[model samples]
Each structure stands twice: as C-alpha cells, then as structure tokens.
Target: MEMAPMTKRDKILLYVVLMLSFIVLYIRFLLIPGIENVQQAKADLTEAQDAQTAMQETILMASVNAADKNTTWGDLQNANAVYYSLLSSDELDTLVTGLELNHNMDPVSLSIGEAGTQNLTGYAAGDNAGQTAAPAGSTAAATDADTDAVTADTVGTTAAGNAILQQILAADLIPQYDQASYFRTSDVTFSCSGDDSDFFALLDDLADNYPSVQLQNFSISTRSYAAADGASVTGNVYNVTLRVVLCDKGGVQP
Candidate 1:
C-alpha cells in the first residue's frame, strides 16, 4: 500500500519545532559566548588601566623623593664645609684675635699648643681639663694650683654631673674621635676679662660657627676694678679662662 501525504497542520508543527531548535542553538553556542567574551575583554582592559595608573604613581613618587634627598645632601655638605674647615696655627690665632676684638674682651691671651694625637682616655680622665701643654719644645704649662682651682670651680660634686660623665663614657667616644685621619688636634687656652654677656656671646659664636671645638674646662671669677680717678667701678668684671680642644679638618701637623 502507498503512504499518504501530510496535511497543512502537521507541516506547520514540524516547521515550528525546527525554528525552536535553531533559537536554542544560537543562544547556547553563539549569543551567550559572545556576551561572555565582551565581559572578559572589559575586565582585562580595566585591569591594564589600573596597572598603568599604579606605575605612573610610583614613578612620580620616586622622582619626588630623589629630589628631596639630593637637596638634603647638598645642604649637609655646605654645612660641613663651613663648620669643619681646617685651620692652621696662624688662622687659629687670627680667629682668636677676631673674637677678642669683636667681644671687646680686654686682656685676652691665647696659647695654642702643637698638634698631637688626641688622648681619649686621658681627656676623659680630666688630664687636660684646665691646661694646655706648651707648644713643641716648650716645657711650660699651667700651674697645678690653677688647674685644681678651675676643676673645683667648674666641675662640682653632683649626682647629675656623674651621670653625664657616665653617659659620655658610654657614647663610644674613641671611635668617633678616630673616625677621620685628617683630624689635627690641638689644645687652646685663652683668658679674657669682660661682662657676663660677653662670655655667653663668645660661646654662642663658637658653637654656631665652629662645630669641631670642644670645651674641656672653664673658670669664671669676679675681679674688682679701680678707676684712674681713685674711685671704685660700679659694674663687676668677670675673668674667664677656658681650655678647649680644637679639631681641624686639614692642616699641617705642626
């Protein structure tokens, strides 16, 4: 027997099923994957932009820090040059003379000893506290009585003083003392008579202008004066003796 042909209703049902299958395949294989690919591209682009921004920020910060470091280093060099510049015997004398004249300190006397290797232990022991050894080939020195008097006047017996001395000892002074080979050590003793203000002003000048000078010992006493007309002066006069250690950066050993 022969098969019969399909009617219009069956044909329309078969066509509708095929169209539905096509729609499903397009959504699964083409449209959904395309949508996912677009999302992934967007994520990668965002990540790259973030990384670029971070790199730019890093570069900018590094440049700024370099500039700051260079400026700081330059400033330090300038300060060192001013404070640590070497001085010869003549230069030291000139500096002392200038200080005397600038402060109007009368009866100023300065004695500069020859350069020598600094004795760290002896210095800390108060061996060179109030006196400077005479220049080479000279046996002269401050009297032992004067040294004792200065020590008694300046370095009193106090707990605080002892603690400070201990701290100085613990500060690794030897290495710091020997760090530079160019250091030329000298002991300078100077005495002056002036008002109290003059003494402090002179100290401030030394501190601000000369960083390598260390005050070892000092003594201050009141001195009475009589005018030429046989009348007593109204104000007090201070006689000050100071022993200082001067370290020059570059100078002749003598």
Candidate 2:
C-alpha cells in the first residue's frame, strides 16, 4: 500500500493536540498529587498548633487553681493569729496612743515587726530571778515576789498587743506596713523603772501598745531626778532604747 502525504496544517494540529494532552496528564497525575500533599501538610500543622494551644491553656488553668488552693482565707486568718500572739495588748495600745500624740511622727509609717533582728535581751534577761535586782542608783530592789508578779502580768500580753496592732494597721495609721513592700528598720525609746514592783506590768502595757513594732535591740540605763520640792528622787528610773525592723509578707523593703 502506498503511504499518503501529510498536510502541514494537519501535522500542526496533531502536535498541538498531543501537547495539550501531555500537559493535562502532568497536571492530573503529578502536580495534583504534590498540591494535595501540601494541603494535607498545612492541615496537619494547623491541627498541631491548635492542640499545643489547648495544652498550654490547660496548664495555665491548673496553675491558677493550685494558687487558689494554697492561699485560703483560713490560712490568712491563722497567720494573723500567730503574728498577734507575739505581743501584748497594752503595749500595742500605748504605742498607738503615743504615735497619735506625736505630731512629728507619721502614724501611717508604722511597719510590721522584723524577724531575727528583734531583741528582748534586757527584758528577757530581767525576767530571770538573779537578774531582777534594780540597777545601781535604783531606790528599791526587785524582790522575787515582784519578779513573779511581773511575769504573771506579762502572760498573754503578746496576743492582746497583736490584736490592737492589727486594728491600728487596718486603720492605716502606718500605711506603709500594710503594703506588700519589703522590710525596714526603726528605732524606739521608752521608759521603765525597777523600783515599781509592778514594773513588769508597765512592760506589759508597753508590749500591748506596740505589737506591730519589734523591739529589735534595746539597752537599759538608769536615771536620777529631783522632786518638785528639790528633794532627791528616791526611785530607780529606767531608760530603754530599742531597734526594730518592720517586715511585710513579700520581704524587707529595698
């Protein structure tokens, strides 16, 4: 059989058809698969991100719950009680009253008692039997009975003092102490006497008055004076110097 000659137009048309077919095959078989793979990968990435976010949220919620459980109102109340038990009522009252009377002092500047730095050296030492003797130049000796009486009077004074201290604090007399700020030191001075058998009662009063103020450090010294008639004063006078630090829950102030 003799072969027929092809027309140029027909050959061009045939080539165009073949090219189009190949392009369509490429898109359907190869490119489409790759595109689908990319879409799947993107979907997977989105799902992973969403899951991670959910997990993080869960962890955050758990942390919040834990914190809520840790600091209950009961716990706060207990802490308050424990803190108040360290001082006497009369002492705290006196401190508040004195601060009220002192125009130069800012009552709101009062602070919580400092730890470790607080000192009851002279007071505690004086409570001992041999230590009860009035200092030199004191008019009367501190007898054992007087010492016992003083000790008895001081009992429970710390708690009462703390209660008053809290009231004063709530009143914001010393706004600084109520803040969550750190701790700071303050100096306090007061008077005492060895001659009075009820001298411990006076100490109790002082403790009750300033429960929030810690007696960080203290010194006891004697003083002498004359009566209005110019007669020599017959009693022992005590002067006390105290160093105290005020602290907050967060720590000491910088």
Candidate 3:
C-alpha cells in the first residue's frame, strides 16, 4: 500500500491511544492484585478477632466452673463432718461435764461402757411396725414389760444423741468413727444428788434438752445415816442413779 506523510494531529491521537493502553495494563497487573491482597488481609484480621473473642469466652466459662466445683466440694465436706463420731473418750467426758454444768447438776459417778455390742433386739428402730406377730407363748404382762423397756430405751437413746450434738457444736475439732456392719451403742451410767425441784426439773426436760438420749433407768431416794445411841440423824441425803444409751451413728468396736 502507498502511504501518505504523517500529520502532527494523527501522531498526537496515536500517542494518546498508546498511553491509555499502557495505563489499562498497569491497572490490571499491579493495582488490581494489590487491592485483592488488601481485601484478603482485612478478612483474615476479622477472622482472627473472632477467634480471640471465642477463646476469651471459653476461659471465663472454665473459671466459673472451677469456682462452682470448689463451692460444691466445700459443702460436701461440711456435710460429711456433721455425721462424724465423737473425737475421743476425753472429749466425750468434757461433753458430759458441760451438760451437767448447764443444769447445775453434780453427778457422783459417770461410766461409759463399750460399743459394738451387736445386741440389737427390740430396740431396732422402725422395725416394730413391720414385725410379725409374737409366738403363741407370748403373755400380756411380758408384752407390757417389753413395751415399758422399749420406751425407756428410746428415751435414753434420744438424750444421748442430743448430748453428742451439743458437744460437737461446742468443740472445734472432730474425729471420725469407723463404720461397721452392725449397729453399736454406748451405755452410760451416772448418779446425781439434788433437791426435788432441781431433780424434777431435770426429769421433765431430760429428754427435751437433747433429742438423742434418755434415762434408761433412774432412782431417787433418801439415804439414812448411821444412828448413834442418842444422836439425832436429821440430814436427809438425796441419791439418784441414771443410765443412758448412746446410739452410734458411726459404729465402733471398743
């Protein structure tokens, strides 16, 4: 083809077109990729922020659960402590002394017997209701006597339990008693001398003061002093004998 000489306007138009094409190539290659990278970075940052928030929440929940567990464990320990047995014989004696002191009572002698007798007979709690009828040879008087004895034993047991509770409340330290297959109890005997008013007051509230113990048997009588040939034996001595049973929540052998 025969070509004409180029004009300044034509060259200017060609230069403008070339510049536009170069600009388009730069935008597609460098600017577009950089913008895409910025968007990706923003998305990654948002994801990381979300992950951090979730982890913080998990840690807080774990702390709360640990606190709750500790509180529950403490409560469980306290409940278990309440069910423990007396610390020792000395502690038991101190408790007895406290009870007597509370009522201004002075006992002549106090004796605590052994446990683990395994001699649960009619005294087994909650058994009478479901018990089978007695054999043919059972007599009415014997039944009456049995009922009386059972009543006395129940009273004694109630008193003992109450006294033990009072002692535990007063004493800070506690010791656990060993658990056994069979039931065990302590037989306590004491003697006191008091006037009619004090003795009667004790008798009235003996079972009421403490719910877990009672007097198995008791006697109050006046003692007679030796009479010389002409001496006046005037002073009336007050004597009282009491027996109580202590049912063990924790069974012990000795």
Candidate 4:
C-alpha cells in the first residue's frame, strides 16, 4: 500500500499528545512529590508548635509556685529524719540528764511512754527524797492514817484508768494517723528538784528552747532540804513534776 502524505493537522495532533504525556510525567515524578513534601513539612511544624506551647505553660506554672517551692526548701531544715527518734526512751533520758547536769539539779524522776502506758513514780536516790520523819503525836498519827487510806483508794482508781487508756492507745484504729506527715505525739513524765532560782531557770530552758516539747500538766511543791555538801546547812527546795506531750510535726522519718 502507498504511504499517505504527512499532514500539518496530524503533526499538531501528535505534538499535543506528546505534550500531554510530558505533563503527566512531571506531575507523577516531581510535582506530586513536592506537594507531599510540603504537606509533611506542615505536619512537622504543627507538632513542633504544640510542643513549644506545652513547655511554655509548664514554665509559667512553675514560676507561679516559686515562693511555695522556696518555703518547702526552708522547711526541710526543721523536718525530722528519725522515725519517732525524739519519743524513744533513750533520747528522753539523754535530754533530761543533760538538762539536769547543766543546771545542777537533782532529777527526782523521769519517764518516757507512748500515749497511754502507766508510769511508775520515780524518787530521788536519797531516803529524804521519798519521805521525811513523821511527827510524834497521837493526833498526827491519826491524821496520817486517814490520809494513807485516801491515797490508797486514789492509787487504785488511777491504776484502773491507766489500764484502760493503754488499751485504747495501743490499737491501730486509723492507719493514716501514724504516717510521717502527721505529728507523732507521746507522753513524758518528768520530775526534778531545785531551788526557786534553779526552777525558774529550768522553766526558761524548757519553755523557750526545747523544740517539739509541749507541757501538758505540771505541779510544783516546796520543801526545805539540807545541802548535799553541807550537812547542817539547809536550802529552799522545789519539787517539780510535769507531764508533757512531745510532737514531731516535721514529717521526719527514720
């Protein structure tokens, strides 16, 4: 078959088809990939912006709480580290002995106990610390007998109450009350003998200086006693006994 003459219309039509193929190739290989890259970059930028915003908010919140943060740092100094260290028997004895020796006072008695255990009355070493000579008269003897009877009854009642209190205090009714954040409150029975001046000094030390020690109850009695060094010389004496509650409010733990 003889080939037909090539026509301009056919040439233009072939050129248009070639151009269309090139456009499709460009979109598939380059333009479409560029568009996808742009979309990916937008997503990454959004993520970065969200992270920056969150960090800024955290910084602002921390700045607002700066004063409380500083206060918490300062309170760390007063916090107790030992779990119930101040309530221990040895610690109480050490505190008492140190105070007594420093003031040159005779410790009549000292006891460390938890909330409700019965404490025995402690007396000083000398016989005179516990008792003095009785008056030699029938009337005095009769009066003494009556007083003794009353004392016996009072002691019996006290014993019964102490037993009940101990039972109540020993139970773990509320577990949270024993946590370090709460105060560890305990009882201390203390006694010491001194002159008026010495007694005042003792009070000043305990009242002004002793930390975490609170006086719950105290009684002071006066008497005359011969000085230990001087047999003939006598001095004014005051017997001081007190019950105190000790607390560690510092969240101290062992």
Candidate 5:
C-alpha cells in the first residue's frame, strides 16, 4: 500500500490530540491519587491534634476535681487562724478568748498585753546606780551577786514551767502544735494591787480551768484600794501575772 504524505496542518492537529490525551490520563491516574493522599493526611493530622487536646483537657479537669475534694473552707480558716494569731493582735485576742472559754475561765479582766522587749535601759541604769551607790570593789561584787540570783531564779522558774508544758504536750491536746514551735514564758508579775484572797482565787480559777496544765513557778503581789464611798475596800484590789509555756503534739504541716 502506498503511504499518504502528511501535511504540516495534519501534524499539528495530531500533536494537539496526543497532548490532550496525556493531560487527561495524568489527571485521572497521578493528580487525583496525589490530591487524595494529601487530603487524607490533613484529615488524620487534624483528628490526632483534636484527640491530644481532649486528653489534656481531661487531665486538667481531674486535677481540679482532686483539689476540690481534698480541702474545705472551714479547715482552711482554722489553719490560717493558728499561725496568723502570732502576727495579728485581733486574731490573738480571739485565740485568747477561745482559750479562756475552753478553760471555763472568766474572760473579764484578762488582758493580753503587748509583747515584752529586752530591758536594756533598765539593766544599764541599774548597773550605773549600783556602781555610784557603793564603793568600787564591793559595788561590782554586790551587783554581780544580785544579777546572778535573779538569773538563777528566772531559770529555775522557767525550767519548772517547761517540764509541765512538756507533759501537756505529750498528752497531745493540740494536734498541730508543732506549727507553734516558738514557745516562750516570761516572769510572772502582778498586773494590779488586790487582796491576797482574790489573788489566790484567781490562781485557783486558772488551776481549775486548765487541769491539764500544771501551775508551777507561780507568784503574786498585792496593793490596797479605796471604794467609791471614800472608804478603803481593805485589800480589795489585786494584780496577777502568770507565765505559761506552750507545747504541741505534732500533726499537720501548717
């Protein structure tokens, strides 16, 4: 068979048809699968990220629930009041009132005085006065003796109170006593002048109130007073000071 000669227009038309067929096959086989894979990957990534976020949210919610279950407002307030009493005056008053009530003591005339500061001025003045009042060698000796006696008395009294306090602590009244680690006792001094009987009565009341606490190193002083009618009440007024050492049975962090 004789072959027909191809024209430039026919060649061009043939090339166009071949290119169109290649483009159609590429779209159907290669482009479609590639696009589908990319779309599937994006969907999978989105789903994975959403699941991770949900898990984190669940963990956070569980933590919040646990915290709520562990603590209560009343417990928090009581804990706060314990240590806070050391810093606040009003809170300290409330604590004292609570203590008095617990001990069945009359809160009346029970004053919470300011914390004591070191009496450097009194010591200095006493030393100077003693030096000027007495001869050189003997003055120093007398002053030293007096200071030693006072120190010994104070130490002895403190030791007695501390022994009692330790027993009370061992009895375990305050569950969180360890939080109140800084315990102290001052020398007992009279608050005012009053009858000897009234002073003893006050001590008795205290003794009755706090049976758990042993009253040791106890002392009293008295003064005279007149009634409103201008007649003397005759040993009517009395002042008392008590030194108390506190102990704690250990429990709780705060």
Candidate 6:
C-alpha cells in the first residue's frame, strides 16, 4: 500500500505550529531581557539625577551663607572654633612671659591656678556672684591666724557653698545644665614692675591678642627700695589677675 499525498490544510497547520514556537522563543530569550535592561537603566538614571540635585542644593546654601556681611556663617564657625580652644598650663605661662618681655617689664611672680567650672546659677552681689566652684585638684592656701580670721569673716559662706558646688559638678547633678553649657576657667595672677605707660600698653596688647583671656583685677602701687650702696630706687609695680576661659561648644576633642 502507498501513503496518501500531502494536503494544503495539513501544510498550513504545520506552518502555524512553527510560527508559534518561534514567537515563544523570541519573547523568552530576547524581548524579556531587553525590557529588564531598560528598566534597570532608568532606575540608575533616576538615582544619579537625585544625587546631582542634592549637591546643587548644598552648594547654593553655602553661597547664600557666605554672602552675609554682619555675621557670615564662616565667621560664626571660626568663632565657635576659638571658643573651644583651651590653653595648657605651660602655654599659659609662656604667653604671659612673652607679654611681659614685650612690655619691658620684670615679672615678680606668675601663678597659673587650677582650672575650675562656673556656677550655673547667679548669686547676689555680696553673695559672691563671681566666685566659682573650685575643681577637686585645687588646694586652699594656708593663712595666718589674723588673715584667716579676716577671710572667714568675708568669704566663709562663699567657701562653704563652693565646696558643695564642687561636689555637684563632680557628680554631674547641675539641673538644666549639660556638658555643652560647661565652661572652664583658669585664674592667673601675674605680678610685674614696669613704667606705667608700658604696663598700660601691655594690657591693650593682651586684649587684642588674646580675647579669651580677660582682666579680672588690676592693682598698681609705688615701690621704694634702698640699694646696697644706700641709693634709693623708686618705681611702679603692677599686680594683675587674669582669667582664661574655654568652652566645648565646637565639639572639640581632648
């Protein structure tokens, strides 16, 4: 027996089957991958655009802040940096010696007291508003009987309160006060002898050079002495007390 001849309907059906398989392969291998690639490219482009926008905004803000005349943002930042600049004991002494030498003055004594913290609350004028809580390392100087009696009469209450204040500061118990508000102060007593004019000039220079160091007390007196040869010498002597203050508002590290 012989097989029957192929029909047109059978041929058309075979072509249709082949076309369907080709379409499925094209979509699975090529079309789907191309669509995914395009989607990823779009996402990356969006991220880059967002980053560029943020950069531009930052630059614009900086320019605006830099244009201010009275108080520029850069100046404020510099002030903050200076506010936190602390002076060590050796540096403080060097600074004082430099000033004395510049003013042609003879230094009699220079003492750098221990650094202490200020009281958060204020006191009345006679109640020792200016007194601070001495740090733990500070030692009270010994006084003679007569001087001790006078000191107790004048500052006994102040000293007692300062003791309590020191404990509070050591324990971090100050209410409504944080570390940011903490400021350290080191007292300096500098005694020197020079011409009155030179001493005044030195004070002016000190103010200009070190704004952080402030003059708290100033005393001047006349000194008369007899030399070995019996000749008398007279001059002016200056006793100055200064306070150097520092803060951590700029987030400076130790």
Compare the candidates by lDDT and give the number of the best one: 6
Runs in model 1 deviating more than 4 A are 1-80, 84-86, 119-180, 223-254
Alpha carbon RMSD to native, model 1: 18.1
Q: Scored by Cα lDDT, where does model 1 land?
A: 0.51
lDDT of all predictions, in order shown? 0.51, 0.43, 0.46, 0.48, 0.41, 0.60
Give the C-alpha lDDT of model 3: 0.46
* lDDT, candidate 1, 51-111, per-residue tens: 9999999898998978865764453333223233445678667766677668767544678
Query: Comparing 1 and 2 by TM-score, which wins?
Result: 2
Better of 2 and 3 by lDDT: 3
TM-score attained by model 4: 0.39
TM-score (all chains, Cα) for each model = 0.37, 0.38, 0.36, 0.39, 0.28, 0.43
Instruction: List the candidate 4 regions with Cα displacement exceeding 4 Å.
Output: 1-52, 59-71, 75-87, 115-180, 221-254
Comparing 2 with 5 on lDDT, the higher-scoring candidate is 2
lDDT of 6 at 34: 98
Q: Where does candidate 3 stray beyond 4 Å?
A: 1-84, 117-182, 224-254
| TM-score-sorted candidate list, best first | 6, 4, 2, 1, 3, 5
Q: Which of candidates 4 and 5 reaches a greater TM-score?
A: 4
Q: What residue pairs clash in candidate 5, if any at all? A: 192-239, 193-223, 193-237, 193-238, 194-237, 194-238
lDDT tens per residue, model 2, 79-182? 23323222333554455436433422212223323333322222343332232111222212222121111121233223332233334334433344432232
Worst 10 residues of 2 by lDDT: 143-152
lDDT string for model 3 (92-123, tens) is 46655566555666555677765443422222
Count of clashing residue pairs in every prediction: 0, 31, 13, 2, 6, 0
TM-score of 1: 0.37
Model 2, C-alpha of 156: deviation from truth (Å)? 8.5
